[model samples]
Target: MSFLGFQLRWNSVLLGALVTAAVLNDVPPSYEALVVLAPVIWADRTTLTWVRIRRR
Candidate 1:
């Protein structure tokens, strides 16, 4: 195993575990909360996407 391969695999495994831990720890989460927040984030993306739609 080369240096790059070892580093990439280590990062992927570590990140996957960290994300799983965070999701598993969040009890009784509000799933619909993201549904409400989705539009807000999309609107906040950038001026380019908006310009393409002629919103501004």
Candidate 2:
């Protein structure tokens, strides 16, 4: 799989786990931050991918 594919799969799994943890556990920030952080990680990955491609 490509980097993107791996990231996508990993992201999906992480998102699900985060959501589940947020609902099941008592830690507020953990789940809330994970919910918020998913997009940031995705955007950063996208930007990095493009930057790497441009350098090639």
Candidate 3:
């Protein structure tokens, strides 16, 4: 798969895992969990930009 596809897939997986964990624990996701998501969000955006530029 392409870099964009890989990043999107993993980002979704991470988000799903976070939501599932919160549900299992009977609590909202914590700040730490959101912190972990921040990097994934950044990487996804970076990868998207790189891919778009490379395709040009």
Q: Tell me, by TM-score, which candidate is best.
A: 3
For model 3, how big is the CA root-mean-square deviation? 6.7
Please give each candidate's TM-score: 0.33, 0.37, 0.49
| lDDT tens per residue, model 2, 3-51 | 4322344555566676688778865546667678768657543223422
Q: Tens digit of lDDT per residue, candidate 1, span 1-56?
A: 11221123343444455557659997543557446545554554222221222333
Error of 1 at 22 (Å): 0.2
Misplaced by over 4 Å in model 3 are 1-8, 42-56
Candidate 1 CA-lDDT value: 0.45
Over 1-56, each residue of candidate 3 has an lDDT whose tens digit, in order, gives 24443334677677778889899999998898789798886665323333444444
lDDT of 3: 0.69
Query: Can you list the residue pairs that collide in candidate 3?
Result: none
Query: What TM-score does candidate 2 get on C-alpha atoms?
Result: 0.37
Residue-level error in angstroms, candidate 1, position 35? 28
Number of the candidate with higher lDDT, 1 or 2: 2
| Candidate whose lDDT is highest | 3
lDDT of 2 at 36: 81
Overall local distance difference test of candidate 2: 0.57
lDDT (C-alpha, whole model) for all candidates: 0.45, 0.57, 0.69
Off by over 4 Å in 2: 1-8, 31-36, 40-56
